[model samples]
Target chain A: MTSLWPIERIGFYEGQASAFYNVSAIERDYFEMWYFDNLGAYKSAAHGNLEGVEQGHRKMEAALESIGNKAREIRDISETERKAGIEPEPSGLWQTGAYTDYNREHN
Target chain B: MAAAVIYRIRYIVCLLSMLSLAVHTALANEIPAQGPFTDSECVSCHSDRNPELIRQWRNGPHDPASGVGCSSCHGSLHADANVKARKNQGCTNCHEGPASHSYSKSKHGVLNRIEAHEQDWRKPLKSGNYRAPGSAYCHLHDGDHDDTMSADRGPEVRQWICVGCHSPRYVREQFANGRRQLDIADLKLTEGKQLIASAANSQTKELSKLRQSLIYHRRNVLYGVGHQSPDYQWWHGQPALDGDLIRIRDAIE
Candidate 1:
């Protein structure tokens, strides 16, 4: 029968075989075949737990995206302000708590 | 005349309850005027609560000199002592430093604030109990569900986690106090993760080596993330397993 085992699966099967069984070649092949079938089951189970980790990663990504979007928007707004011939750059960058927030960039 | 007497009695009851409440608040905020019991009472219980903290305290330049106890940080008042006074006033009183600062900003403290409105804030802490290895209290051994917090059920397991960074004498003391078991592998993973977190948070030359070691540590990836390994790997005579050895090597060095 053809095996659907990938390279990673084959390596892991070898380790599992070495750890669990030290029988004849036929026995090793039988265990490897069993593991090959079981891999699908384990992968499905693992996906259940990975859902939360994936969600956490998405949240972190969202935070990064918001930061990037805000910076770009600020730059565009400043450029527009400059073209209008008002105060060269908007003082919003240096106003009030902006200086304290700037210090956050240094460390 | 009788109506005035009833009103006066009601006023007295309100005043007494108010006085009782003020006294409770004072007791909660008041520092212990005397040192804790020198006996192993603190260690006996706390060694079970947080053997890891006990281990750190033993070697952490406090044992031989001033001899800190569980009360030094968590305070001595039991839950039954007073309502709100049982929450650890001692640690906040003196350790207004980095750990306290970081902890206040941590998710645990935020959760604590939310829970403070409904439940007794000092329930577990007042009962000489500490949150377990994978508790939401810290990022040390946090597992799948972030909401549930569990403590080490075994005294030996608790002590074993402590001996990772503590001195031999302190380890022995902890072991004497119902902590006979030991596990180097578990301690290595727990401390290694904390080391990594500390290194990542603080940028200092002193933590550079720890950061390097933490970055390269292979077992860290699979240590708490998976099932069945941490428990059996320490107890059963199993060969050392590395989950992401190659990935860790590439990431670190």
Candidate 2:
């Protein structure tokens, strides 16, 4: 049986939904790269600079990559949910004002 | 010599009599019989006629003093007082001035020359279902209001729409004398100031006092017969007059 979760909501909270959601699909992205990178670290050790500066940079880069890939996945899921006449919960940086800058640059 | 003098005298008398006769004829020639209307002829076409305009005229200045009657502008309807006999010459018969000069320039008069324009014009004039209470329209148009016009004659006469007689330039004159009179005093600036100054120089005052009183008294003039005493005085009249006076002074300098 399919999960009875509500989907494709117009203005749902991003943090509460699945993280793999593309937040910048339609709106002007107002989030900067550093913002997305920092948000993805969540208070984990990966956010710290203990592993040398170069390693820290690499970790920050990886965080950005994860956020971006997760965002695309979320967007695809959203489109699918919408096509099926279900409203998926809003997810990703767009809802939470996280990837706003990144989205604006591309737009 | 005596015979020659007598002949010249007879010739002079004949000339004088001729001039007098012409004047009498001009004044006495009965207005031509017009369309199906007669005296009170408007009643037939305008049935259930309320003579509001006539009543106003009876009580108004035009009754006997101003020498105007309904028949003045609209002409007489001796035979048939229908609309056609009441041709457009009524107003032109007597009124001669810048008004007549300028009316020829106005769009209404210009457009009126076209055939059937009378029918087009009649729409607005007749559609209002308004019949003048008596002949107030005649009185108002002729500026035959009873009371001597003053600067502060309140709104009834102040808000008058004088574009019919005077141009916008002459409109400035009504406010000039500080009295609502549309006569010569308001029509000309020299006359306006002179009249006011003379008033102020009332038997009891010096020139300065006369000037002050003139300023005080002249504050009440109304620019038109309809709308705005305060707004007109402050925004349009006082400022415009003062500005005009300044320009005149500068030109003289």
Candidate 3:
């Protein structure tokens, strides 16, 4: 028989979820910076900078790798929890009976 | 000798009379007939139909004092006023100068190269599609057509005309903010730096190029030509563009 996961374990998963959210926010900024640099490179090329485009590409790849590592860490944490017989249940944070009832009534 | 003098005088009178008759005929031919409606008849008919247009024209610089009536600009008043006849030539007839000459050479005249590749000036050009002000836009704001009629006569009027598009706050709100929010659907940026990041991501290559071109035309060409203000063209325009380019470069790296 499978036992219910401890509250501390659930809290740990929630903490991991929060970290994932934070990482996503950082990734967005990183990608935006990459694009800005890419545009700068394009502008530079318009003038006479032959290597600007290649340099922009390299910087973008480095940013992507940094973001990718954080994503991998999230995946590893999830995988470890799954192996330990821990599964996420629908938390009251997202939905309550009020929303379901409202949807049901509207539908 | 007296007889010869009398004959010459008679010949000169005949020549003068013939010249006067030719001049009268030419003047008559120049004035086009207003279809079924006379000038007064036009006022009577359109007084109820499009009273506001009549009022706007009456109040404008083309008022009775200026001797520019409905027939002067609009040509012959047909059942449906023939709009094709009412060309920019009508404006050029009176407003001949460097300002008017530069208009055709300006970016506003050649808007077909921009987003509005197949736009017709006969109909109102859409506000969103318009990159720069044409004769119609400078004179008539958003099809109001009462700019000259309602304009305040002073230097401050330039602000009223230009601030419609040139204000950075207005541009950011209209183009940048909405586009940023829409482009990044899943991830929302609440912080100021993050919002700027989102905006940067949303910026397209085509749009950026178009905007840079627009700025060049607006500051360098349009403002100077339209207002005949040489100071703005050289002093303000080129420096502003240089500064903006540096900002764009620094924002990247």
Candidate 4:
């Protein structure tokens, strides 16, 4: 594979992999951003449903934390493979994403 | 002496023939993989010719902080009459899980993926042009550029796309409510930020938890509002901002 000069194709792949993992976690977490309106946090001040709010808050916090974990997984997996100095198997890349994309240039 | 000169000429001719064959072989191998290559090469020229695309790719959901270039989805075959990337297949190729699990599972996704034949993907992502939405319909739908005409931001971004199926009244109300929810969330986030910034022992382990919670969850807050919601179900999103804000308050005080 011919890595195009200056595109940082490996970096691009890392980013895509991280994004997919991140999105995957979001789906897994069920943290729907589109729907739902004000309730827990606003009412927490009045001592209304404080326990439920706290639990929801904690769950949301954990879900948010997973995005970072997903990104780290991509780097850890690829960095190990990259040290082997072998190319990603030809069919590895995807639109949801893959571990690497650019061709390693042969000078 | 004449015989010696003739022998040297023949040897030189033999060497030139071998060199020519090697050069021809190399070129044959080169053209098929690279120019015929799709993704990054698409950017090389487009970067110069259409910088805005580079901008969108860099800033939008598809690329996020990473890069998913033209050929990644579009493929290598470019010509006057066809742009396969414009089709949903272009997006679905890589989005088997992300779109497939989410939008592809939705009615809109099903109609676009399953029903709407002859949808003319080559046409812009305009509402009537498509039977139902695809990945680009709302996200990449400014046709050519995301912020084209310096267009309105936020929910109004999809007005043109939605107007065909929905009433103007419903659209206006939805945007109004959506904007209100976002404003409240943004204000709460600001409150949390201000409190954290003024806190004592900013670098301590105790504070780091609050900081991490606030910062990381803040991204979720933004994305939560910004992402496509299937039902836009009532009240599910507001509590997240509330929870983070409340956590910030308790930690700071």
Candidate 5:
């Protein structure tokens, strides 16, 4: 019979995959939505609405500043969890993108 | 006199185009001619037949204000709307920009580039169905047809859409943090702007460099924040803005 009390599971934690997955997605969507919204505004300004063009550009900048920090925060938290050896479920979010620094400091 | 003649011709061209569109629409709506959808005929016929599509459109960001109709996105061809939506060509017809570069940088884009055909696209455009939210999912409100762009307004109104995949609390917290960071970046921008204005010599190469630095800061802010791109914000965003401020101050000196 297989022992239910499994010790020293893969990836240092049982839920590591899930926690990483959520963090990966959170960072990614933050970037993706920003891309989508930024383009939408550019298209709007390009099509017309020159009056709001300057403000529109400023708003886009503000959003980037905000999202970049958010992504970093998420990455750091996940890294901390990894260090702590706390695990999540067994799903995965593709750890990609330079913005999220997903590959930073990994063994 | 030559300019006046050109203006006159342009005015006549506009009038004729409007007249042709009006005639085309009138025939489509009144004559009940059965063929490919011409103008607003899809809406006219579907208003009674389907009603839901029309209702969704009426409530969405498009329709009367956007001047976009069924034919605009779905095209005049008698193809399936679901099939048309699986790809982004319909939305991209009008919403073009450099956002693709950001998307391509993402792993999602990289994955799609390699194995997009592996996706079960026939499953329809909805939240739980697709591996990820495509352009239609975001813009069309998960097949709502209302064209509700929740992300445009911000997280307060549309975090529900994200709740499909993420915890609401996590998303809200991220949005709040993002807002705060943006405020801080704006302050940096204000300082840079003042420095640029106060600089004594506007025509000097130093002043020109300052002007160029300000533009870069704006670009960094947008690319950095909008894409959540650490490559931009960490390397080029806050740090670059700090660098720009240094550049501006040096120029003033």
Candidate 6:
């Protein structure tokens, strides 16, 4: 009778994945800058810049932790809903008349 | 009026807190990472644990005053008690100049293809071949790191390092052969110069110059200096140059 999955859960997971992607992008940039620093040019400034990047990394780690916590909360709530025999509502995109018609035409 | 004053005081306190936080963040970013280990810590631990190595390092040219410590050559990133990480690049990192440049071209450098950063020192000695001396063996022979005495003595000290692989007799023989070569080079240079003087044509002038250069080449002075081999300098180098000059002169005549 009740839906286990929240409509917003997909967006929440997407947001978490995006945060991780951002962290990966930042890490790649940090590594590149670190290699450039090792080449002996802009040595002093590069050191300071690396320190800044490390701080940014810590911030990203905190954000990831926050996202992880949110994911756990969602999981717990979904588990509770599942135990109650509530089925997840179908996605609106899949349930749409246009999607059904497209599938029919492809078939 | 009292409420207004209290509100203003709270605003000022909040502003100060924010300013402090900004300053702290800026300071954190500006500070470089203090390496995991300090020189004093390294010395203190190794002094008793590896007394011999510590003693060698202490006596050697790479004292703390020289701005070179254990980590300067060995690197600080390695785990504690990791001596195998010591590299030749550590020497070249600071000693990059003509002398170091020449060493790279010397027989030792060419044969070993001396990469300062390579961990070849850790490998067991290759049998049946002259394992050309690396920077470590040459400078730190028998744990006599004190180069102050050696520096004053010059190439003689280097000769001591050389004798580890090359016997005194062998060196003497090589020197004798080198002298003979020098004589030959001189005779040719002298004859060439005589021929050039007689003709004085552009072709003869060029030939004379080539002969003179050949004489210089025979001297092997730069090669000796680069190798830090005194025998090579006097017996092989200077005499060879002098001989080449004679040879060119003779050739011209």
Best by lDDT: 5
lDDT of 2 by residue, A27-97 (tens): 11223234343444443355564444454456667656766786697689879988999965543312222
Question: How far in Å is the alpha carbon of B253 misplaced in model 4?
Answer: 5.0
Model 2 agreement with the true structure over B42-86: per-residue lDDT tens digits: 533333344554555566545645777555654554443223222
* Count of clashing residue pairs in every prediction: 1, 51, 0, 13, 9, 37
lDDT of each: 0.39, 0.39, 0.48, 0.52, 0.58, 0.51
Least lDDT summed over 10 consecutive residues: which range in candidate 1 chain B? B141-150
Second chain TM-score, each model: 0.26, 0.34, 0.43, 0.56, 0.62, 0.47
Cα deviation in Å at residue B252, candidate 2? 6.9
Please write out the lDDT profile of model 1 over residues B1-253, one tens digit for every residue. Answer: 9999999999999999999999989976764334444446657765876676667556543453566554554445443333322333333565454334434544434445455556544343311233321122222211111111123334444444444445667756534422111232233334334433433344554345544543334232222212113322221211211221111221232
Could you tell which candidate, 5 or 6, scores higher by DockQ? 5
How far does residue B2 in candidate 3 sit from its true spot (Å)?
Answer: 99
Could you tell which candidate, 2 or 3, scores higher by DockQ? 3
TM-scores of all predicted structures: 0.22, 0.27, 0.33, 0.45, 0.48, 0.36
Q: What is the interface RMSD of each candidate, in Å?
A: 20.7, 35.1, 18.1, 17.0, 16.8, 40.8
Give per-residue CA lDDT, model 5, range B46-115, as digits (tens): 7887688788788777766788876777667655656676665566576654344444444444554566
DockQ in order: 0.02, 0.01, 0.03, 0.01, 0.02, 0.00
Better of 3 and 6 by DockQ: 3
Candidate 5 collision pairs = A15-A87, A15-A88, A16-A88, A21-A93, A64-B225, A64-B226, A65-B225, A99-B230, B60-B146
lDDT of 2 at B232: 38
Local lDDT at B94 for model 1:
56
CA deviation > 4 Å runs, candidate 1: A1-107, B1-85, B88-111, B120-253
How many residue-pair clashes does candidate 3 contain? 0
Candidate 4 TM-score to native: 0.45
Residue lDDT tens for model 1, A1-107: 23565443211111121232223222333333344334434554578756555554555455455546755765897799889886853332112121123223421
Evaluation by DockQ, superior candidate among 4 and 6: 4
Off by over 4 Å in 3: A1-107, B1-36, B79-82, B85-87, B110-117, B129-132, B142-145, B148-253
User: Candidate 1 DockQ category?
Assistant: incorrect
